[model samples]
Target: MIVHKKPEPTKVPGFWEIPSISFPIHIAKNFAKHVNILPDVEYWSPFLNSKTCNYLRDIFLESMILAPVSINGLMDQSYGIGSKRATGWSLQLSDMLSEFIIPHLNEKFCSAKTSTDWWQENPKKNQAWLPVQVSPLFRFMKYESGGEHYAHYDAGFMYEDGIHRTLKSFVIYLTTNQSGATRFIRNHLEDIDVWDRDHSDWNRRALKEEVLYSFLPQEGSILIFDHRICHDVDVYLGEENLPRIIIRGDIIYQAKSL
Candidate 1:
């Protein structure tokens, strides 16, 4: 009897293939000067210049069909409405790329004092925290004209030891659009009685009164927030010719003994 073995997965491309552009040091330094539009959320614009953004977008669009696309990491053809509305393409970033971008994100946004304070105040304070790393696995998502994600919270990825996990989530907008704002809610998922009862029964647009903030899509802008925040995407009202495009990933920190 002859048996067939499963095929090995194809290796993803490395980061060096991505075009390297100079970091916008001046813009990043003034990130704090922006008006406090949302609580516990940091927003920075033009993180990548127009040329870089366009190049990245073109690369993704060109290779989207060849890349591994999934819904919440599952290759299942049928997905429930509650999981996500946008189409996600998973891309693996090389260690070299993670090292390249993490320092910019850390020095410009997460200072040593801030990291130390967060570690000390965390409930899992017993474990020593290592420097944060940009997650190797990230999704480049595209939303169509009618696409809309239901209210949901993000889960952290356990990268190293059980104690080391993703503490923050970030979105980098690759394309600008007239609609499809990411809306954050003031209430927690547990606080919403209907959310627990049935996801299909939940109305995505009914939470306007509870909205804490709404971030419109802007090219080359980055938005970082706590992983536990409950948020949803507004219905994409852009023209059929344009789809909302963004990169979503987590910031992971390793834990070690002192």
Candidate 2:
């Protein structure tokens, strides 16, 4: 699928708390061939005004927006666009990853530019409230049918307005298959309600400690969710001998440090 016009915004569930987001993913052949060779996965693109990055970030801070994401590498060179991670249907987050991910954040929010500049965004009375610095961590996993992930959730804030943190998540879909779709275990905002409260029941029983959730990925489908919800990605079991690929990114900023 080829995208020409800017997409229309859809009011999704509470994925917006960390602020979740989702968009109609588009994919086609050969998208992988050219983008796959991108060296320095962290390469910075200086064209700030370019729509490429603007549209990607536009998914969130709608008005005059920007975003930052840490992405994974591409699948085997032989795989096409919807079959690889980097080349999948994802917004170019490297613009934020390299240019704004770290440096811009430091300059914009906290005063921690250098390691020595580790100024506290918020000081906890005790280490118990040390305030976790949650970040946007992303991954690209390939699997089919039974290879899909079950329902799960992430660790959430233990305090209300106290020590809150937004574990925002976004996924980029590359291929379109009737079989590959994202499903939510419970209501969406449940994650947002507990965003600042210590909750882990939404996570998987096996990796309870990791707070990792499963995603049924497609080539260029992007899904963003509240970091604190119970959700899962359904597998893509198309019989046409096609592989699933996705390019994922994490856009994390300090919890209201600015």
What TM-score should be assigned to candidate 2? 0.38
True lDDT of residue 170, candidate 2: 44
In the range 76-115, model 1's lDDT, one tens digit per residue, is 3344221122222222342433553466543223222221
Q: How well is each residue in 48-88 modelled by candidate 2, as lDDT tens digits?
A: 22233224434433421212111111222222222211111
Candidate 1 structure lDDT: 0.55
Error of 2 at 115 (Å): 30
lDDT of each: 0.55, 0.33
Best by lDDT: 1
What is candidate 2's CA lDDT for residue 255?
43
